[model samples]
Target: MKKLFIMLLTAFVFAVVNPTKSEAKVMYDGAEVVKGQTGKMTFKKDIKVYKKNPNGSFDSLVVKRNNFFKTYDIEKYDGKTFYQMGQYRVQATDLVVFKEVPIEIRSSFYNDPIYININRDNGMGSYGYYFLRYQLTFLDNGYVDHCFSDGDEGTDCDRYLGTDFKITERIEREYGMRYEISKNAEGKGVPLKESKTEKIMEKGSIVFAKGLEINGYLNVGIEGNDQEYFWVPVNLLKPVGDK
Candidate 1:
């Protein structure tokens, strides 16, 4: 009977010393974690996601920057910290909290009513070449107006007097890689050729009439003029009253 009791005690001690997989809990560093937290991430370039193993090595996962995964747990393994994002592990430095800010440009011309140049850079080289993407000039009476000139040098006969419009939505639209526009939210996907001649606000000048945010673009009315408007990109247009 004593030998039977000793055998039972030995088995219990062995079971206690070697816990099964079902008895083990997830651990960070040397401490046990019951649950994890969550966070967001953004990237500038494509990156690979990795899965950690018990042997302190990583296995590649078929994930990239386009994959959206929120991290839930933070763990330290092999002296490096990683975010437990979903079922994958990613280096903490690889994640970022992103925010987009609008770009602003001021008129370089010095006059009572300055000529606004709506020029965009060709996607090439350092700084690239600039040509007028849209046209605007001061009227003979110093009234600001939108004008058209073929390429850069031509008669400014084609003119549109801007008018005040309403704001609905404003979105950041990109052209090539260097230029961005404030596209109207409502008129998206409808080709501009089918739309009316609305002045798209450029990076160099503010010559439009109405400053209404229709879609993702801002339709701003020219100062003192109610007949013409410039449709500027919401991301590039400066706030009103910002000197």
Candidate 2:
């Protein structure tokens, strides 16, 4: 009876220690994209999709370039990027990164032309030379009658949106529309023309939606306008919440 018990114990220990390679579970490091961030995917060649199981070895599907999809929730495995698309984990390459647009100046200010007269006596007799300089005007439009300058006051000053307005959220995932500013950069609320705008929003397109804390602003494609971009308030944007 003692010999039989010993043999049974040895068999149990060997079975537990010597599991098959296929039965061994593989562990992966955990990583994910920042919550609520949007990402675009592009691939140079066809890629295989895998299940997010412990082994992560089973092939579930194949995704070609023509039908590549975007990934909202991303993870990293073995130095490759993976997204939780559909029911399985899809590996993605050639990932395009979207950076947050930063706001530079909060309060609105405009450029004003200033002329200075300098009398320099460089041994060639004193003569006045006129030079131009720009100064920042910090007062709100309604408060001041006109722009103040050394030689001129009550002159028209270019108005910019006050800094009180902010972008509460961004609309990422959804297609963004392309536009052209109706007027020059100084024209904040210029009306948009339907003819010059692209109906569909492309990747990296800038859009300021309405229904925000303040009205959103956007310029899809400005026709003949020298300005690359203009700030507009958008209040009507609903972006995915912070993940």
Candidate 3:
């Protein structure tokens, strides 16, 4: 009985001292870590990129600072946050992640408008209609690519537009302000004033307009409608398109 008790105590001590791999505890008392975050990041300074070894260690040096890489996953290990780029892992502290803001451009005109002309007939003796559509792709480099289709065929023109413009001053659309068509003493239309209702345009709001520039203002459509446009100060807009 004494030999059996000694063997049982020894087995319990071995079990407590050497736990199985599945029973091992991972200790982490760091900040909140997020996983599965995917985005583009640029190196803030020259840093080392590492790859995990088969023995659960990241001692393998893949490469040095390569400037930019697209992150596939974000996770925390050893109380440090790492961004996974393919098989490589980078520390989050040595990189600047580009967080994309939600941007929406809505038009008061028709949504995905399509125009059909039944008068056109193809060589196969089947009538076809024309489809007109416009698309805007916002690039990461502060530029927007505008693509529009012609009424007859397909895409007609593609151009890049600047989107770093901000409203500098308060723009007010005054109501009850009328001008007479006939010339007055000043050789210009006579202005008639009445009680005005002000529609204030918010300052510091980012805006994009047409490429047409006249005087010191840009011709901006009211709601993506080309026929109705208003003028905005050109000095407030800084073009950041590729030269």
Candidate 4:
């Protein structure tokens, strides 16, 4: 087996907005809400974009109905009408993409900074990842990428200050099959703040069996013990079977 430096890049979650103009409420934590952003939403397609309108209203962004990586514009609303704009939570039970990434055995604890030891059960530092300033941004076609664009504005590298962490273990949706995450709570990995002592990795498999929780929107990365170079989002290791 080839050894890979797993980066565990952070998943970019775009804000979903509710499309309704009248009263609205959020049903989920908004962490994985799709079709609507957290806290509130607006079906008010008529509302102009926030700062683009010459009239100073919510100037609706114009969106190309394509997923082309380039030629996508998201920062400004050109002219795409929203269907919804509030939190639409996706529980672990609701996980549908079981095979897009590795199955981390820990909680994300998103939206805050945390401290963890990456030392795996067998002394492998597979879980010790770190991040600099990793903010989220959406493209015109809805593909969210880690901030820090492909090019520089000028001499500035646009280097934004970010956070760092060390964890004992990590758990994430299994990548590859892109199909199912176990609906059985007993089989499905636990969520944030939950700790377990059972060893999760097999004898020969390279795994991060510990748990680490970081608060609020983190930029994920993993560093090897050699500290040569860190990687983001381990490219190999997709889901094997079910959750």
Estimated TM-score per prediction?
Answer: 0.21, 0.22, 0.23, 0.18
Clashing residue pairs in candidate 3 (N, C-alpha, C atoms within 3 angstroms): none
Please provide, for model 2 over 36-113, each residue's C-alpha lDDT reduced to its tens digit, 9 standing for 90 to 100: 222335455666666655665565676675444444434432445455555565554453232211112211111322
Cα lDDT tens digits for candidate 4, 162-197: 111222222333222221112211111222122232
- Top TM-score: which candidate number? 3
Question: In candidate 4, how many Å is residue 189 off?
Answer: 26
Better of 3 and 4 by TM-score: 3
Cα lDDT tens digits, model 1, 78-140, are 445455567676675634432111010112111121121111121211111111213344344
Residue 99 in candidate 2 has what lDDT? 23
Each model's lDDT: 0.38, 0.34, 0.38, 0.23
Return the lDDT, model 4, position 184: 14
**Scored by Cα lDDT, where does model 4 land?**
0.23
Q: Give lDDT: candidate 4, residue 122.
A: 15
lDDT value for candidate 1?
A: 0.38
- Number of colliding residue pairs in each model: 32, 20, 0, 64
Q: Which stretches of candidate 3 lie over 4 Å from their true place?
A: 1-37, 57-59, 62-66, 76-80, 94-243
lDDT of 2: 0.34
